[model samples]
Target: MKRQVKPIREGNSEPGTVSLFSIAGIKTLLQFLRLGKKSGALLSMAVATAIYTWFYQWEFALGVTVMVLVHELGHVAAARQKGIPVTAPFFIPFLGALIMMKRNPRDAATEAYIAMGGPLVGTIGAFVSFLIGLFTGHSLFYAIAYIGFTLNLINLLPIHPLDGGRIASSVTRWLWVAGAAGGLFAVIFLKSFLFFVLWALFVWDLFSKYIVHRGKAAEYSCWGKIEVPFDQIPGENWMLIPFSEREPLPYRTYSDMDGKQWVDINWEEADVVHPVKMQEQGLIRSVFSTKVERRWQQTPKVVVLRYQIDYEPHEIENYYEVPEKVRWRFGISYGALAIALFVLLDLVQLMMNEQGGFFHSLRK
Candidate 1:
């Protein structure tokens, strides 16, 4: 016998009023759909839907698109709540969608929550679809459940730029190395062209980080002259020097290098120049180095000698260091991983033959 599924609404709330749940859902949707500069998100969403329609039937395409929309809106809501200005949900045809934050997150924990929002809400959506399929005998509902689950799983693959990867790296920046490894595994095992593309970006980022840390930057001795070519100057446009315990020191620069730029520094400042001994020593070392190299070495190394900005001549390394906060808790992070694994195992069963797969179970 087919199971009878109760409707969410018992009956009419009143003669002329909307139900509480309906109002809440509508308000939530409206809040996230608040399009400021990201009105283009709607256009992208339409394009994605059209493309999916070309690949599948309109009904299937619409269902999948709605699922993705819900997932991205989840991100939008979290960002807004965290007081981070963000763009609306922008969709990509096959690669899914994203919300562009206008500014950096307050901290690693904020970023982790924003990343988690999508999958948490998306999983709920998929589960709702699953229940609908189970009760209504609708294969389309089953497809939505399966596709939603799988898409979220792919997104949580702990690869840099992915939600899971971003969340993981927030705990410790070094974890990006692990993310890179996972990306490589995906490329070799999944053999997906998308994975290959993301992997290429990941590799470039890794190389950039390596060069930033171990190369291009100079440390201050007692007295040293660091001659950086105009082309070799770091922070050609904008520079952000962050201190762990304090606000980031920021600078803006113009691009005008005649030949080379150099800085003469005395290391004595490390002791008495600033109240703090440039805490978080390695914080921006890699970032600044990579930024400089990428800016200057676009083509052949040109020996240019000129001044670019109203340069400040100060000690080389005199910023106070700040301790990095371990925001992501092991228990919460591992819990999420466990849930993802459970979802994956369930997905596998849904695809299997003997376990009555998604289709077979739905048919009954």
Candidate 2:
């Protein structure tokens, strides 16, 4: 007798089935337009964003939107070049656009290029602005470029998830997960609410990428094992790994020869142990206390490949898929500084003893 082909069934609903998009029709439409998957929680985020945008529509805030959009588009453009299906940029008023990446990127190189694409665009934009500034003597042009490029540079840090971060991960797997965890904690301690939330969002993703869907036979070296707090750590039984109900709580342990003695480790092992969250959302000190949560509610889904990595028997609360090297290349750009520069220029405009009636006639 011939056997019929078996069907593959995932336990939960597919991507975009989350309950974060249960708001009203218009809000729902906007959320869907920006985000790919549907979730009830996203609806709440939409409501919140709409309310916040109502109060703050200042030019500076709008300019920040432009900076973020350009940064996101850099990734989008790279994705398009790589033949990845990407949604149009979703304009979120004072916030910014969130690209809806339909599928996981195929490899590290692809991810890196996509991640760098945004910063690259910003760098070019900044260069153009700098050129414009050189010609017109209008410092604001340079300031805009600075704002555009600086954020990209920050994203390029090899800490984890950032474009530069992926580069670091590709070099050493242990450092990659450790870097991600450290970056998350650092952002929280720093009081960067925006990045703090983004980091929190990755807690579960990290577990998924490192533990649940670990690459087994790949030629690349990765974190072989992670130890957590006695209670938080998974059981010693390796077969019991991959409990997805909760994200894996990964910790560190070092073993001596013959695998007898084991010692617990800490953030010191991580290549980059961030005190709080990342520096996104404009909050530098993005450390989240045990009480508060992250600010950026609408976290974009992280893209990652699968089946090649080995599996671990545990759970990760919030995991994220990221690239390597490109995240750490700070020398590549400096547009964020433009924000500060623009502030100073505004001051200069205030104090300049101009002969013509330009600032007084229009800008003022």
Candidate 3:
């Protein structure tokens, strides 16, 4: 079943018609799509959503529409701060807008803020609404605020597409991993019994896909400026020549376009790559991809050994009572199952309400 995700906040509230759909990198997509501006896609989506919801549920629908708008505004706001041009914020129902950016985020700070735009708005809206509800004494108003606030907070919880999850991954991938573990544990401990099975499905998604996804990026801090120059580097390019595969290849081969017969240099004097690095504190463990020797000495080094990111050392160090596998099984995944159960029950209730015949069958 294609489970529909709603922008629900605190308690079980009515779902707004809009859903925000996002994939990892929109910048890359621009290149693929060969489009300088992507505001059109977002605009069209917003218009369609507004039109659709206008015909259907107008009032409850408007809140959803606003949240979607706020989310886009976040992107626009962040982009403006970074001196990047954001075309517009569109309000789309179910599928939200595509924020058109003049350029990609320049740095971590820029990325974090831009990423955080939507949820922050939701948080603010939720809090404001909540406070208003307190004054007006309407439980429903408070519920709306709670929904907005709670959804934003939950989205910030280090799950992808949700602001927090993306931010966590961008900042420190390991922190996000730890957060996942913690979230799993918390869900299990707090047995509200709502989202467990869904959590289990998420766990399965993690293991099946990204667990050992070996995308390793290494930088030796001690490497005192090995200046490898590029011919036509873009102004926005953050230069880090990635040694993806055969790391044994020391980066000594300079441009010989002048046609000089070069000897195969012994580059072993320089730094080497290792998955685990010895630091002032201890062995600094990098995640999944082994980052061979993190500290490249000023001296030359040849095909120093390369290492993939390994979880063994980390798992050993953070040895809890049980493996993450077992820990997650009982956690919010169960709550997800509960959610499924609740849905099933609600469906039954609705059917009974409509027919008043299911009970008759039970009595017979």
> lDDT for every model?
0.56, 0.45, 0.43
TM-score of each candidate?
Answer: 0.56, 0.43, 0.39
Best by TM-score: 1
Error of 2 at 279 (Å): 26
- Worst window of 10 by summed lDDT in candidate 2: 277-286
Please provide, for model 3 over 1-364, each residue's C-alpha lDDT reduced to its tens digit, 9 standing for 90 to 100: 1122222131222244745543335445556767455544554555665685665444434554555566567667766777776666544444444564544443444555666666655555655654564576444444344335444555555554445554553445554566567567756765635445535555554654454333432222211112222322233432354444333332222223332212222223233221221111112222221233333443332222222221111112232234344334433432343354344334434433443433332222
Comparing 2 with 3 on TM-score, the higher-scoring candidate is 2
Instruction: Show where candidate 3 strays beyond 4 Å.
Output: 1-57, 90-102, 138-140, 182-364
Residue range 1-364, candidate 1, lDDT tens digits:
1111221121211224655557557456556888645556776788799999887777778878888988888788888889877777889987889887765554556777788778778877877877786677666677777788877876776667888766665565566676677778868987889889997887765775466434443232211111233344345442243212211222222222321122222112111111111111112211011111212553444222111111222322312111354443632663575486477548545643343665554434
TM-score of 3: 0.39
How good is model 2 by TM-score?
Answer: 0.43
lDDT for 131 (candidate 3): 57
Q: Write the per-residue lDDT of candidate 2 for residues 1-364, one digit (tens) a residue.
A: 1111222122221444556545356566766667544443344345445554465433334445556766777878889899887766655543345665565554555656676677667666656655665678764554455555556555654554566665444334555566566766668666777777666655655665556546731122112122122232334652243322112222333333332222221223122221211111111111111111111323332211111111222222222233333334422222343244455444333433342332331232
Per-residue lDDT of 200 in model 2: 64
> In model 1, where is the ten-residue run with the lowest total lDDT?
285-294
Worst 10 residues of 3 by lDDT: 273-282
